[model samples]
Target: MIRLGYPVVGVADLTVAAAFWTAALDLAESPEWARDSWRTLVRQTDGERVLGLMLSDSAPEQYPRIHLDLLVDTTAEQETEVERLIGLGAQRVDWDSYPPDPDFVVLADPDGNVFCVVDLSRAPSGS
Candidate 1:
């Protein structure tokens, strides 16, 4: 049997990405897993590894095929989290593909990696 590990994001600058992600998600840098070109971020509450960052020279995709979706219970919480993430250096994406009434907001990290903040309460009727 196999188990999935944490998501690994490619970033242009390891230091900057590490700082933003750790603060934005309330994670802490895992010093034991630190490397010259890699960072491991773990949950502060339980020390469970959640995300990894890898130094890469390639640019982020404008429309990434795979992306993270941060969840919130309510639309109000989603709105607040979006603002908070922007305050932490995330930029709102001018996504042209949004539905007429989208339950998710698109954003890009400092490194331009795209992700979504989804409101569970506003999810599609069947979803």
Candidate 2:
């Protein structure tokens, strides 16, 4: 009855976050980019529903218990991606929820919304 969709990460400045993600994921903003308050709303090449980088003026409390799962090929590669993300605008976080031998690294976006980069491992080597 319900279909999952791309996730949104709210931010204080859409343009800043959009710039970061455009570099991190090598994606470009949609032609429909609002150029205003919704400037951060972006679409991937696949035409997935726009992922929002909403302004902080929206609300408090992290919504929906959602975090974007960015898939990489290996944990070592994931580590490198984490470093790259840090260079982009991410901060490392202590995600106790994940396992010891994690296939991903948990981190927060520019606005502090958390997400994880997961390695596309054949076996569930880690949480």
Candidate 3:
């Protein structure tokens, strides 16, 4: 059976992206594969990698079809996490696609990669 691997994010400045992501996710750099243009971020709990950052000059998609969702159990947690991410250089995205009573907040990383902070507790049934 095939298993899902880490999501690889394209970034303009690998060093800055690496620093921001590591702090945001509480992950650590994988020293074994660390480089100027690429870095792997590992989860601190089990030392398993969560994602890979690759250097790229291309601009981030204005409306990416694929984006990461950081899940939190409650709306309070989601709000707190959003604030923390903003403090870590992430910017809140003024998204226009939200439904009524939305349970997620859109945000962008330092490189303008879009993602969401989702509150699972507020999700509709069977979602």
Candidate 4:
């Protein structure tokens, strides 16, 4: 049987990206996986590895084929979290392809990597 591994994100500056991600997601850096060009982040309370950041020189795509989607239980929480993330250096993206009643907001990390903050209470129909 095969198992799925955690997602790895490419970032131009690993230290800055690590700082933003660790604070934004309540994760902690994993020293065991530390390297000059890469860093692994784990859950703060459980030490379960959740994400990895790899050094990359290429620019982030305007429309990435894959991106992270963070979930919040309520619209209020989603709004609050989006603000909080912005306080931590995230920027709101002016997405052009939103549906009539979208359930997620687009945000870009400091490195310009785009992701979404989804409100589960308003998730798209049939999703």
Kindly list the per-residue Cα lDDT of model 3 for residues 8-86, writing each as its tens digit.
9999998889889999989998885888888999999999989999999999998898889999999989989999999
Query: How does model 3 score by TM-score?
Result: 0.93
lDDT of 2 by residue, 37-108 (tens): 664344466755557665667542343376688889876788789999999989888666776666677788
| Span of ten consecutive residues with least summed lDDT in model 2 | 55-64
Q: After TM-score superposition, what is the CA distance of residue 55 in candidate 2 from its true location, in Å?
A: 1.9
Off by over 4 Å in 2: 1-5, 40-50, 58-64, 122-127
TM-score of model number 4: 0.96
lDDT against the true structure, per candidate, is: 0.94, 0.72, 0.92, 0.96
lDDT-superior candidate, 1 or 3: 1
Runs with alpha carbons beyond 4 Å of true place in candidate 4: 125-127
Clashing pairs in 2: none
Candidate 4 contains a number of clashing pairs equal to 0
The TM-score of candidate 2 is 0.76
Q: Which stretches of candidate 3 lie over 4 Å from their true place?
A: none
Output the worst ten-in-a-row residue range by lDDT, candidate 1. 118-127
- Give the lDDT of residue 63 in candidate 4: 95
Can you write out model 1's per-residue Cα lDDT over 1-127, one digit (the tens) per residue? Answer: 9999999999999998998999889999998679999999999999999999999999999999999999999998998999999999999999999999899999999999999999999897883
Candidate 3 lDDT for residue 102? 98
Looking at model 1, residue 79 earns an lDDT score of 89
**Which candidate model has the greater lDDT, 2 or 3?**
3
Worst 10 residues of 4 by lDDT: 118-127
Which one is best on lDDT?
A: 4
50 Cα displacement, candidate 2 (Å): 5.0
